[model samples]
Target: MLRLFLRKYRTMILASVFFFYLGCCLTINFTRIECAFKTSSKNELETRVQSLSKAQYVVIILSSPNNEPKRDAIRATWGNFVNNIFVENGEIINKWNHTRISKQSQQNVVKLLFVVGTLGLSGTKADKLGNEQKRYKDFLILENVEDSYKNLSLKLLNALSWISENLKDMKYVIKCDDDSFVRIDLIVKDLDAFAPSMNAPKLNKFVTFKEHLPTYKGLYWGYFNGHAEVFLTGKWQEKGWFLCDNYLPYALGGGYVISRRIVDYIAQNMDFLSSYNAEDVSMGVWTASLNAINRVHDVRFDTEWKSRGCKDNMLIRHKQTTSDMFQMYKSLAQSNGEKLCNTEELHRKTYFYSWNVLPSSCCKRN
Candidate 1:
């Protein structure tokens, strides 16, 4: 009888312990979930700007009044190319104007904002003495920020705010100049492939430049003037190449992409000092400061695409004529049909390069 009573007591004790442990686990999990929820809520304001549906891609170009001619030219060419090429392939192209975008479709559209500064004076008048007088407000001017670097910081903040307010549902955000032309089909394929690749970094998006250095003493490569001298330090010096990770804080030129999370973070926290020159470099610095990793892709940007032939697997081509942009679009649309001869040859040369290169020099040691 005593043995039976002891067995019952032991079973009850075991049950009590099991329940206690389970309760503790449930509490911990609930706490973690709450924290994640808060973080998501904070980031939602920015991430929600990404529209994932109207089309798979969003292209952003910065244009000024001076570039209107080029814009018109490119638009005409694209109109022809889209009609002749993309429509036949069943690929739909939608113009992402602020008014026409739907709430649901807006959520899927990528937001691209071009930040174009005016070069010429606006609204000038001759004074009574026949001397030319310029109006301050009419001039494209930077805010009076601390240093030149701070101007860019402020520009990004303002630009991002404009984007968030106007394009609340975009999925991606790209900032490019008027002279750049992206191979939309190639960019879409690359992003689609990159999105699922385990090798890609979860944080810090891609940045393109001539070179990078991590341990250099002065400003990072591409920080100063466009033609700044390249410094040598660390293993990169020996290899005669710059890595993106080292000088991310001072990146410049071409353009870059920002995921919704980072954009939201920046929008929420826009207290950085402004920089007057090289907004792109300041952006790199700002992103680096946020603990984001700026990655480098192998795609060639900011070069004459026509000279190299329009068929390369490159995601973007810089310094393009309006005609070149249209031609490239047409080529991509017809890629499924009889392949264009030049494009085929260009693809053959470019397909061997992989976008999976790592920022760390670990492999070099081996």
Candidate 2:
């Protein structure tokens, strides 16, 4: 009788055992796959951070989405070079050193990349931009903002956010337009000499004010304007929330340098910052509220509504044509960094920024 009962239930018991074993195997495989995916994601982020750490200074060039030629000119000119420092096996090496494949390394690269905005209308230029980015791997596209003259403030916002996300470890960040000409070597020389002094804001020991209370901290270096009147009606008017008779003091957008702390501070408060008509003005307004800020106004940066002429010592010059860029690069490269423009070409008369005069006439021509 026992043997007959076992035979009757044999098929059901075998089926139950097989199903249990199959379920256990599937569960184990799924968990392993999920863990692999997570590990891969984490590793990708770590790799990005490690690679980006090689740059001491990064220049974020604001470019137009459709202006591929402008970007190309920049690439062929001053923005073409790469000099990154890496530490491998307790030794310092450069990116060009192809001798040793470093298993473990620390990267510090000083490089430049273009930050462009999206084209809201069609996909033609957008597709081209995507392909260009893939080729160079140096583009930071702001998907939310449209690339237009009026929307530059938003473009700047997204650019700084990108820096905060990827290149936050860099010592300094320089923001400039695509048309600007940058003499990076000269700028680097000044930085090496005056970095500590640059970091410290000019404060008086006798007077205690909120602006000067902070010590050597946020350094904002560029050509600054404190008396730009608010225009109510014009092509470059301010209808935004910047309710002021004069715009807050800010470095001109052509080419300005900011310390890492400044970038971090801006990133931390990105969500609440107001949008202004001009990106430079927006920067000034947003930074006006910070407790610690060191504003360094230097005339060497020829960044303004117009160029202050071609001075030999100028570090940056805005409103350069594509042709002008090629010419400038050729002059500098051929003369071994002595001459600026061709001898035949006319150099504009240089002017000074009268900061000591009346507040209303701060940047007036002498």
The CA lDDT of each predicted structure is 0.42, 0.72
User: Tens digit of lDDT per residue, candidate 1, span 255-292?
Assistant: 44555555666666666543334456456555554432
**lDDT (Cα) of model 1:** 0.42
Best by lDDT: 2
- The C-alpha TM-scores of every prediction are 0.47, 0.73
Worst lDDT 10-window in candidate 2: 202-211
RMSD of 1: 23.1
- Candidate number of the best TM-score: 2
For model 2, which pairs clash? 53-107, 54-107, 54-108, 54-109, 55-108, 55-109
